[model samples]
Target chain A: MLKNIQEWVMVFLIIGAIILIGNWVGYDILPTAAIPGILTLIAICLLGLIIHRLLPFKLPSIAYIGILGFVLTIPGVPGSTYIVQWTNEVTLLAITTPILAYAGISIGGSWADFAKLGWKTIVVGMCVLIGTFMGSAIIAEIVLRFQGII
Target chain B: MAQQLQRLWKDWRLHTLVLAIVLLTEMIGTHEVSIGPGLILLLPMLYAVIIGIALFFTPLVNEKQTKHAEQLVFLSVTLLIAKFGVQAGPALPKLIAAGPALLLQEFGNLGTIFLALPVAILLGLKRETIGMTHSIGREANIALISDKYGFASPEGRGVMAMYIFGTVFGAIFMGLISGFLSSVTPMHPLSFAMATGIGSGSMAAAGLGPLVAAFPDMSEEIIAFSGASNLASTVTGLYMSIFIALPLTEKMYGWFRGKKDKNPTKIPSRNQRRCYKLC
Candidate 1:
C-alpha cells in the first residue's frame, strides 16, 4: 500500500509537470494569466478526487468536482475573484485540449474492438445518433418557442 | 503495491504520449490552417481524429499500453466536467430561473431512446439488444448491462455496438449537427447548448464547440448551462434507463414482433448462486 501511494505520487508529479507545459503553451495561444491558472486547475483536480471519495453515490467524480468548483466561484464566495481570475476562458480551452486529445488516443486503442462489431453495428449506431440529434433538437425548439428565448 | 506502481508508471507514460501528440497537432494546425468561421468549432475534434487515426495505424504501443491509455479517460472527463461546472456556477441562478424550459430540453435530450426503440426492434434485435440500444449506451450503461446480463449476451453485444459507434462518430456528428442547427434554427443558443449535453462529455463538447465559436462572449454561460444539463442527463438518464427506458423497449419489441413471449426466461437463483460461489 505504501509503494502504491508512492507510485501515485510519482504519477501525479508527472501529471503536474505536463499541466505546466500545457499551461505554458496555452499562454502562447491566449497570453493572459499563467501560473495561477495551473494552480487553480490542480486544486480542482484534488478537490474532485476528495469529493469523489467522500460521496456515497456512484456518479462520476467530475460531477462533484464541477459542483465544488462552481460553488467556490459563485459571486458571494470569499475568494471568488481569485478563482475567476485563475480559471479564465482561454485556460479552460488549454485544459480541454489535452482531455480531447486523450479521448482521441483512447478511441484509437479501441479500434480493433470497434472493427469486430461489424456493419450492422454501424446501422444501429446511425439510428441512435439521428434519433438523439432530432429528439434533442425538437425539444429545444419547443422550449425556445414557448419561452420565446430565441 | 509494486504491481500497482507498475500500472501507474505505464499510465503516466501513456498520458505523456497523448499530451505530446495533442500539443504537436495544435501547433501545426494553428500555423498551417486558418480554420475559418464555420470550421473553427471542430478544430479540437479534427485534431483528435487525426492523432487518433495516426496512433491506430502506427502500432508503436502494445495492447497493454493502449489499455493503460484508456484508463486516463477518467482524468480527462473529470477535468472537463469540473471546468464546465465552474464555468456554469454563476449561471446557476439564471438557469434555475428558466427551470421548466430547461427541463423540457433535457427530456428532449433523452427523447432519442424512444425514437430508436421501434427502429431497433425492426432490425431483428433481441430483447437485450433492444434494451441496450434504447439506453444512452455510455460506459456506465455498458457496465450495468454487462454486469446484469453478462458481456457475451445479446444485450452486451448491442451496447458494445453503440459504444463503438458513439466513441468513433458521436463527437463529429454532435459538433456538426449542433453547429448547423444553431446557425439555421430560431432556437436560443443556450437551449441548443443545453440540448447538446444529453449525457456524454465528448458529445457535449462537440455540440458546445461550435456554439462557443459562434458566440464567444457567451461561452461561459453556455458552458455552465450545458454542463448542468449534461449532469442532469447523466444522473437522471441512468435511472430512466434502468426503471423506464429498458423496460419500455422490451415491451415495444414484444409488441413489434407480434409474438409476445408470455414467460420470459428468468435466470435461476441456483445458477446465480453457483456463479458467485465459483467467483
Candidate 2:
C-alpha cells in the first residue's frame, strides 16, 4: 500500500509538471498560479487512494477518488471554496493530453498481439466499442428527452 | 518504498517522450476538418495519441518504454478522474436534477451486448462472443471472465483479444466518433457527455474533448455531466456486469449461436485488481 502511494505520488508529480507546462502554453495559465491547484488535486487524489487502501471491503479506488473530489469541492464544506478555486485553473484538456499520449505510445507493443486476434476479432472489437458508447448515448438522449430535461 | 521509487525513476525516457508529445500537440492546438455532413475534430490529445502510435512503431522507441507507458496511463489516469470529480462538485445539483437519466444511462451500457453479440455471432464468433461483447472488455470484465472460465479457455482468449484492441483503438475511435456524432446527430451535447462515461478513462476523455470544443458555452456543464456519469458507471459497473451484462450475454450467445442448452455454468466471485486499462 505504501509502495503504491509512493508510486502514484511520483507519477502525479511527473504528470503534474507536464500538465503545468501544457496549462501555461495552451491556456496561458502560469505554472506559479496553478501549482497550488495541482497540489490540491494531487493531495486529494492520494488521500482517496489511502482511504481506499485502509478500507476493509473492496471497491475501486476511482470510486473513492471521485467521491473525495466531489466532497471536497462542494459548497458549504470547509475549504471547499478554495479547493474549487484552486483546481479551477487547471485546464481539463491539459491533463488528458499526456494520458492519451500514453494510450497511443502503448499501442505498438500490443500491435503484434492485436494482429494475432484475426479479422473477425477486429470487427467484433469495433462493434463493442461503438455499441458501448452509441448505445448509452442513444439511451441517454431518449431518456433525457422523455424526462423533458434536454 | 525507496526501491519502488527507484523503479519509478527508470521510466524517464517514456515520460520525456510523452512530455514532448503533449507540448508539440498543444502548440498545434484544435482543428476541424469537414467531411460530408460531419467533421473530424482534431484536438491536442487526439494528435498526442496519433503521434505516439506513429512514434511507437519506429525504432526511436523500445519495448520496455512501451510497457512503462502503458503502466503510467493506468497509474496517472486517476488524476484526470480526480479533476473531473472536482469539476463536477459544485454542479452537483445538475447531476442530481438529471438523476434518473444518469441512472438509466447505465443500462445503456448493455447496448454493447445487444448490438455486438448478434454481429459477433454472425461474423462466426463462438463462445468467445460472450466474453468479447460483454461490458467493453475492460479490466473488470477480464477478471470476471478469467474467474469464471480461466484465462486458458477460449472465452479468456476472446476477452484478452478485445481488451488489447480496445486499449489500442478505443480512445482514438471514440474521440472521433463522439466528435462526429455530436456534430451530425443533433443530440444535445450533454447526451454525448453521458455517453462518454462508458467506463474507460482515456476513451471518455477523448470522447468529451470535441463536444466541449464545439460547444464552448456548455463546456463546464458538459465536463461536469461526463464526470458524474463516469463516477456512476464506476460505482455500478461491477454489479451490473455480474448480474446483468455477463449472464445476459451468455444467454444471448447461446440463442444467437442456435444452441439448445441454456445452462452452461455458474459465476464465481470475481478477483479484481487495480486495473483501469482496457488492455
Candidate 3:
C-alpha cells in the first residue's frame, strides 16, 4: 500500500508539474502562483485514496477524490476561501491537455487492436457514442423545457 | 527494489512527450469556426490527443512505453475529478434545483442501447451488440461485461470495440458534437453541460470544452452541472448496467436479431425476476 501511494505521488507530482507549465504558457497563471493550488489538488487526491483504502466497504476512489475536493471547497467549509481561490487559478483546459496527451500515447501501439474491431464494430461503436450523447441531451432538453429551466 | 522502481521515474520520455504536447497545444489556443449553423470549436485538449496519437507512429514511441501510458490515464483523471468536483461544490444549490432533469438524465443514459443495439444488428453484429451498446462501453462497462461473460465473449468484444473507439475518438467526436450542438440547439448551456458528463473523464472535459467556450458566461455552471452529473453517472452507471442496461440490451438484442437469444435469459436469469416486488 505504501508503495502504491508512493507511485501515485510520483505520477501526480509529474502531472502537477505539467499542468503548471501548461498554465504558464496558455493562461499565464505562473508556475509559482499555481503551486499551492496544484499541491491542494494532489493532497485531496491522496486523501481520497487513503479513505478509499480505509473504508470497510468498497467504493470508487474517484468518487472519494471528487467528494473530498467538493466538500473541502464548498462555500462555508473551513479553508474554503483559500482552496477555492488557489484551485481557480489552475486552468481547466490546461489540466486536460496532459491527461488526453497521455491517453493518446498510451494507445499508440494498440491501434492494431482497434483495427481488429473492423468496420462492423466501428459503425456500432459510433452509434453507441452518438446515441448516448443525443439520448441524454434530448432527455435533458425535454426536462429543462418542462421545468422551464431553459 | 525501490531504487530500480525509482529509476522508472527517470524515464523522462513519457513526461517529456506529454509536457511538449501540453505546451504546444495550449499555445495554439482555442479556435472557433462556423461551418453553416454548426460551430467547430477546436480545443487544445483535442490537439493533445491528436498529437499524442501522431507521436506514436514516430520512432520516439514504442509499444511498451505506450502501454504504460495507458495505465497513467486512470490515475491522471482523478485530478480532473477533483477539479470538476470543486466546480460542482459552490454550485450545489443549482444542481439540486435541476434535480428532476438530473434524475431523468439517467433514463436517457439507459436509452442508448435503444439506438445502438438496432444499428449493431443492422451492421450484422450478433451477440457482441450486447456489450457494445451497453453504457457507452467505458472501463467500468468493460469490467461489467468481462466479469459476467469473460473477456473472450462476443459481448466482451463488443464492449471493448466501443471502449477502444471511445479512447481514441470519444473526446474528438464528443467535442465536435458538443460544439455543433451548442450553436444549433435551442437548449440552454446547462443542458449541453449535463450531456458533457457522459460518464467518462476525457469525454467530459472534451465535451464541455466547447460548451464552456461557446457559452463563456455559463462556463461555471456548465462545469458544475456536468461534474455533478458525471458523479451521478459514475455511481448509477454500475447499478444501471447490472440491473437495467444489460437486461434491456439482451432483451433488445433478441428482438432485433429475430433469431438469436434462443433462451431469452442468457446468463443473468431475468426470469428468476432478480426481484420480489418489481416483477
Candidate 4:
C-alpha cells in the first residue's frame, strides 16, 4: 500500500490540475467529466480483471450499486417544478439518514466492543464528537461574555 | 471475495437493524406530531450524521473482514455529502463566505488527534492504527484500492485506474444532475456541480455547467419541475451508485477465476501497527 501511495498522489494531483485548467477554460467541464470518469473507472477495473483473469460473470455488489447510483442521477427534463421539489426532498433525506444511521450503528457497535475496554472507547468517541462541539460552544460563549457580544 | 461478501452480509444486517430501529423510533416519536417541512427534511440529514459516526467507529475487527465495509463507508459518506450539499443550497453564499473559516475549523479537527492519542493508548490499537484513522489521504488510498482489490491481491495500478475513473464519472453525473435540476427551479447549477464534485469528486462534477446551460428554457414554473427532477436524480443517484458497486463487484468476482481462500487473510487489528504514507 505504501509503495502505491505515490500513484494515488499523482492521480489526485492530476485531478487538481484538471480543475485548475477547467477554471481557466471557464467551461463546466468539471461536472461533465463525472460520466467519463465513472465509465473509465469501470472499464479499467474490468480491464484489469480481464488481464488478471478475474472478471466474473456477475459483478461485485459495489459495482452494481455504482451503476445504480449513476442511473439514479440521470438528468430529468430540463425544467420541471415537480422534479426540483421532489429532488430537494429526496436529497435532504438521502444526505441525512444514512450518515447518521451509519454513525449510530458504527458507534453503537463500537460501544459493544467498548465493553471489552470497559467503556473507554465509547467515552472517547462520544467525547470527540459531542464533547468537541460542546466545548467549542462553551468557549465561544465565554469569549462572547468577555467581549459583551452575547 | 467470499470474505468481502461475508463482511458485507454482516454490515447489511447491522445497517438494516439500526435503520429499522430508527424508522420505528421516527414513527412512534412523530405519530402525534405534524412536523414542519424544515424539520421533516432535517430528520434524514441528522440521521445520516449519527449513522455516519456509527459506521466510522465500527471497527474492522481485522483488515480483510469485509472489504466492502470500506466502500460502504465511502458510499455512506458520499450520501451525507450529497444530502448536505443540496440542503445547504440555500446557504451557499454564507458557506462560501465562511469557507475560509470552515477550512480552518476543519484543520482544528486536529482536536480529535488528542482524543486519539489517549484512546489509542488505552484501547491498545497501536499508535499507527490510530494515526492512519486520522489521515485522509491514507484513508482515500485504502478506500480506493480496497474497493477494487481485496486483501488477497491488491492491484494498485488497477485500483488507481478505477479511482480516477470513478471520480470523473461521479463528477459528471453530479454536474448533469445539478444542471438539469437548476434549469427548472431556482437552484444553482454550481451548487449541484460542487455537491457532485464533493460527493463523487471534482473531476466529474466540473463539466456540469455547460450541460445545464444547454437545457431548453421552460417558463420559470416549468423549470421548477426540472429542478425537482435534478435533485432527485442527484440524491438517488449517489445512493444507487453505492448499492450498484457492491453487488456488481461481487458478481464480477464470481465470474472471474479466483477461488475463495478457505482461510482468507485476517483483518488488520485496530491497534495493529502499519506504515502509512503522509505524502
Candidate 5:
C-alpha cells in the first residue's frame, strides 16, 4: 500500500511538471498560476475519490471530480473567478492528447486477444458503429430542428 | 483492494514512458504538418494508432509494460472527463434549456444497441454475446458484466470482443463519421457534440474533434454540452444497461428464436481477473 501511494505521488509529480511546461510553452497560463491550477485539479480529483468510495452506488471517480469542478466554477461560489481563470488557461486538447495516446498503446497491447475474437467480431463492431452513428444523427436532427438550433 | 492498488502501481514506469512518447509525437506532428482542419481532428487517434502499432512490434514494450499502460488509462480518462466537466460548468443553463431534446438524443444513442441485439440473435449468436453487443461497449460495461457473470462466461467473451473492437476502432470510426455527418447532415453542432458523448471518453473526443473544428466559434459550448451529455450517459446508461437493455435483449432474442435458454452458463467463482493483461 505504501508503495502504491509512493507511485501515485510520483505520477502526480510527473503530470504536474508536464502541465507546468505545457502552460509555459503554450502561454495558456502564467507559470505562477499553473501550479495552483494543477494543484486545484489534483485536490478535486482526490475529493472525487473520497466521494466515489462513500457512495453506495458504484460510480466512476471522474463523475465526482467533474461535478466538483463544475460546482466550484459556478458564478456565486467563493473563488469562482480564480478557479475559472486558472482552468481557462488549461487547454482541453492538451489534456486529452496524452490520454488518447495511452489509450492507443493499450489497444495495441491487446492486439493478439483482439485478433482471436475473429471475423464475427468485425460484423458485430460494424453493426454497433452504424447503429450508434445513425441513431445519434437521427436524434440530433430531430431535436435540433424542434429546438430551432439547426 | 490492496492487490488492485498494487497492480495499478506496477505500471507507473510504463505510463511515464508512454506519456513521454505521446508528448514527443504531438510536438513533432504540430511542427511538421499543418494538417488541414478536416484532417487535424483525426490527429490524436491517428497518432495513438501509429504509436500503438509501432510499440506493438517493438521489443521495448513487453507484456509487463503493456499492462502498465493499460492500468494507467483510468487516470488519463479521469483527468480528461474532469476537465470536460469543468468546461461544461458554465454551460449548465444551456444544457438545461436543451434538456428534453438532449434526453431524447440519448435514447437515440441507445437505439443502436437495441438494433444490434436482435440482429445478433438472428445471426445465431448466444445469449451472452447478444447482451454484450447490445450496449455501448466501454470499460464500465466490461467490469459490470465480468462481475455479474464470470469472465469465462459467453457474455464475458462477448463483451471482451466488443471492448476490443471499440478500443481499436470505435474512436477512429466516430471521428470520421462525425466529420462526415456534420458536413452532409443539417444537424446542429451542439446536438452532434452531445451525441458524441454516448458513454466513452475517446468516442466523445473523436466526435467532438470534428464538430469543434467545423464550428470553432462554438467550441466552448460544444465541449460543455458534450461533457454533460457524456456524464449523463455514463451514470444513467449503466443502470439502463443493467436493467433495461440486457433483459430486453434476452426477451427479443426469445421472441425471434421462439425459445429461451433459462439456464445460461454460470462459471464458478474464482479470483476475478481482467479479460486481457493489457486491456
Candidate 6:
C-alpha cells in the first residue's frame, strides 16, 4: 500500500515538474531561475541516493558540524572591543559546540562508545589543537605574503 | 556530576589558555593588519587538520578522543565563520532571508530519507533495527508542533526555538534591568543589557545586531560593552540549561509519574529507549 502511495507521489512530482518546465519554457524563463533550482534538486537527490547506497545508514554528522561552526562564528562579530564580550562568545562556542558535536556523534553512533572517552580525551585534544593552530599561522602568513595583502 | 564538571573544567581551562595566549600575541605583536581576517579563519581549520594528522601519527589515540577534539575545533570554526560573515558580509536579516531558500533547496535531502525507509521495510529489515534506524514519526511530530506550538516545547525543536525564546525574553528583561541600573550609573542601559544578554545566544544576536545597526555612530567600546554584558548571560544560559534544565525536566517527569493513577494499561507499550535511539 505504501509502495503504491510512493509511486503515485513520484508520478505526481514528475507531472508537476513537467508543468513547471512547460510554464518556464512558455514564459522564456528557462536559463534564469528554473534551471538552477531543478538542477540543484536533481544533484541533491542523486547525492542522497548515492550516500544511502554507500554508507551503512546513519545521519549526516557533517551538517551538525557545520551548524557548530556557524554558532562559533557568532563571536567574530565585527567592531566589538569589549574583552568580556569576546571571552563570552569564545566561551560559549567552546562549551556548547563540543557538547552539541558529541550529542550528534552519539546520535549517529553507539552511545556506549561515546561514554568511554573521559576528560583525558579533552586534554590530548587541546595539545593537538595547539599544533594545528601553529601550523595554520605559518600557512596563513605565507599566503598573505604571496597575495601582498599582509 | 562531579566527573562531568571536572571534564568541563579541564576542557575549558585549556581553551582559555590557548585563546588568551593567541589573542594577546595578536594584540601585542606587530602583525600586519591586512591579513587579519583570513588568518583568523585559517587558524581553526589548521587546528582541525593538524589534529587529524596527530590522530594518524598516534596509534594510541582512541576514536572517541579524536572525535572530542574534532568537535571542539568544529565549534571554533563555526564561531569564526559567523563572526566573519557578520563583519565582512551582509548582516543577520539578509542571512535569514536567505535561510528559507537554503532549507527548501535541501528538502530533497530530507525527502530521500522517507524514500529509503519504506524500501528498507520492503526488504524485510529487522523490525527492532528498523525501528531504531528511522525517526520519521518523531520528526513529523516535531515539525508539526514547531509550526503549531512554536517555541514552547523545549526539547521538541532543537536550538532554533531556544534561540527565539531566549532572544525575546532576554531583550525585555535586559532592557528593563539596564534602564533601572543606568539611572544611577554612567552605563548606557541598552549597551549594558546587550552585553549581559549576548552569551545566552539568540537574544544577544538579535539585540546587538539591531542596536549596532541603529546606532552605527556608536564607538566600538560602547558596542563592546553591550556585548561584554551579554557574555555572562549567554554562558549562564548554556551552563544552566545543561545543569538545571535536565534535572528539572527529570524531576517534573517524576512528579507527573508519581501523581498518575496506577493504571498499567495507560502506560505506553512502545519502547521509548528504542524509539529515541534512532534519533
Clashing pairs in 3: none
- TM-score of chain B, per candidate? 0.77, 0.89, 0.87, 0.29, 0.75, 0.27
Q: Please tell me which predicted candidate would have the highest DockQ against the true structure.
A: 2
Candidate 1 wrong stretches, greater than 4 Å: A1-32, B1-13, B28-41, B126-129, B147-150, B259-279
DockQ of each: 0.51, 0.66, 0.64, 0.09, 0.49, 0.02
TM-score of every candidate: 0.82, 0.91, 0.91, 0.33, 0.81, 0.25
TM-score of 4: 0.33
Q: Give model 6's clash tally.
A: 22
Order the candidates by TM-score, highest first. 2, 3, 1, 5, 4, 6
- Candidate 1 to truth, TM: 0.82
- Winner of 1 and 4 under lDDT: 1
B103-202: candidate 2 lDDT, tens digit per residue: 9989999999988889987887777888898888889989999998788767888899889888888898888888888888878899889989988888
Cα lDDT tens digits for candidate 5, B1-37: 5465456555666656656665565554432222343
Q: Which ten residues in a row have the lowest lDDT in candidate 6 chain B?
A: B37-46
i-RMSD values for every candidate model: 2.9, 1.7, 1.9, 14.6, 2.7, 22.7
lDDT digits (tens) for residues A18-67 of candidate 2? 99999898789999999999998898889988998799868888888888
DockQ of predicted candidate 2: 0.66
Proportion of native contacts found in each model? Answer: 0.51, 0.77, 0.68, 0.14, 0.48, 0.01
Q: Identify the runs in model 4 with alpha carbons over 4 angstroms from their true place.
A: A1-84, A91-95, A98-113, A118-127, A130-150, B1-22, B30-77, B113-279
lDDT of 4 by residue, A4-102 (tens): 333323332332232223222332233343333323332332333233334454433233333333333334423323322433323122222333343
- Best to worst by lDDT, what's the order? 2, 3, 5, 1, 4, 6
Q: Candidate 3: global Cα-lDDT?
A: 0.82
Q: How many backbone clashes does candidate 4 have?
A: 113
Where model 3 places Cα greater than 4 Å from the true spot, the runs are: B1-8, B259-279
Model 6 C-alpha lDDT per residue in residues B1-279, reported as the tens digit of each score: 233323432453333323333333223322211232221121111122223333333443344443443333333323322332222122234334323322222212122123333333334322211221112212232443345334333334322322222222332332222223333334332323233332323223323432332234642333333333332232233333334433443343333344443542232323653365557
Candidate 6: segments with Cα more than 4 A from true spot: A1-150, B1-81, B84-100, B103-109, B128-279
